[model samples]
Target: MPLPTPPPTLLRDAALFLDFDGTLVPIADRPDAITIAPGLLPLLERLQAALAGRLTLVSGRAAADVRRWIAPLEVAVAGSHGLELGTKTAPRSAALEEGLRHLRGLQAEHAGVLLEEKPLGAALHYREAPGAEDACRAAVTRVALSTGMEVQPGKMVFEIKPADGDKGTAIQTLMQRPDHAGHRPVFIGDDLTDEHGFAVVRDLGGSGILVGEERDTAATHRLRDVAEVHRWLNDACEEMS
Candidate 1:
């Protein structure tokens, strides 16, 4: 499919929020296979400078994972679906440790599923064994029922993350920062998890860009894939110069 061209208004935005997997890096078979291109950090750094520190990366992975892939970039990062938040300069808080510990402890009881401990939460991946879907769901459901954490279902993965910490709150928090205070927000993502974020940006008088072929999204715009998002981002950054 051809990439959708971004609207001219996108280039004039003040704040930019991006997703990591399937946005910055292409999706891979194993979540760990996704590689951050060598140039991605430099590209984002240039964009950050152009956007005046109004750029942030929000993802389900741990903030450390994001940082490892795109190291030494001073952009704000919200990891574990916003349960672990941090700026470039400040050390990340460990408030989610209890939740992480609880989720990690469930792995022994849940069979045929793998548990990944994230910065602020945990994820149970059942993609490799489709036959274990029910077990996976049951495991995650059991965990959610026991703990107050919300279950965020994604492509073959169920994450037990903080209910209150979402992309919307992350956006609001990022916007409140001094550099992003006056900027109009622009959020771009490609999952059901991103719907609330789209609504938040819309409510804030900004816009959301959905990256997929799905219809009826809360996003104001839709692009085809990660490459399209990158192309549009490059164009936006260039236009801002």
Candidate 2:
């Protein structure tokens, strides 16, 4: 009773969507501390070409942030939990300005809580302060309600984003492009925010590949970690070649 490998045949007509962070690179103590492997850019370039420009990186980080990390590649990217795609960045709610002040207050109380400011929203990472999870979630929930945003919970993090923006809408939007149209979707991600993309791929008659240990997920396939993802992409690229 182990997870089955995804059929290589699916790559034949796939419009690939990838998640950054825990999928492309390992999660870091600080958001900016991740180390991108030297070969990652080349691998993505190869895969993007093999897929005929249908590969897109959908990430929770802002578009500029993601681009800055993977510079010179120039591939399609959906950032800010899909709130920012290409050159478009979603606007933050007016309340977020005041919300940030409140979050700053919370950060002062907890020594290790990391507060990340994005174009559309903000996130509180409590990885360094495990005991602050409940307080962080509560504070973020309050901010979300006041800002007309939604609370998005991920691994040891809580975020507030525009209520309408999500990875599902991001993938669906990209699928309408001429190069992406008619191609089945195959999204790979790890975290609660990715469930939106997972559900969308299933609805589109494609699939989702989850990275990390198994849980109740919409993704049909499980890849143990980022290394497996690299291997899978290498195999897919070779198959296409």
- Which prediction has the highest TM-score against the true structure? 2
lDDT of 2 by residue, 1-241 (tens): 5566676565777899999989999999889899999989999999888898898999999888899999989888888998787676546556889999999899999989999999888999999999999999999999988988889999989999888869999999989999888999999999999999999999989899999998888899888999988888888888888
Backbone clashes for every candidate come to 0, 0
Report lDDT (Cα) of residue 5, candidate 2.
Answer: 68
Cα lDDT of candidate 1 equals: 0.75
Model 1: pairs clashing at backbone N, Cα or C within 3 Å: none
Q: Model 1, poorest ten-residue lDDT window?
A: 87-96
Q: Best-fitting candidate, measured by lDDT?
A: 2
For candidate 1, lDDT tens digit of each residue in 183-229?
89988888777887898988998988888776676788888888877
What's model 1's lDDT at 53?
A: 72
TM for candidate 1 is 0.86
Model 2, C-alpha of 121: deviation from truth (Å): 0.5
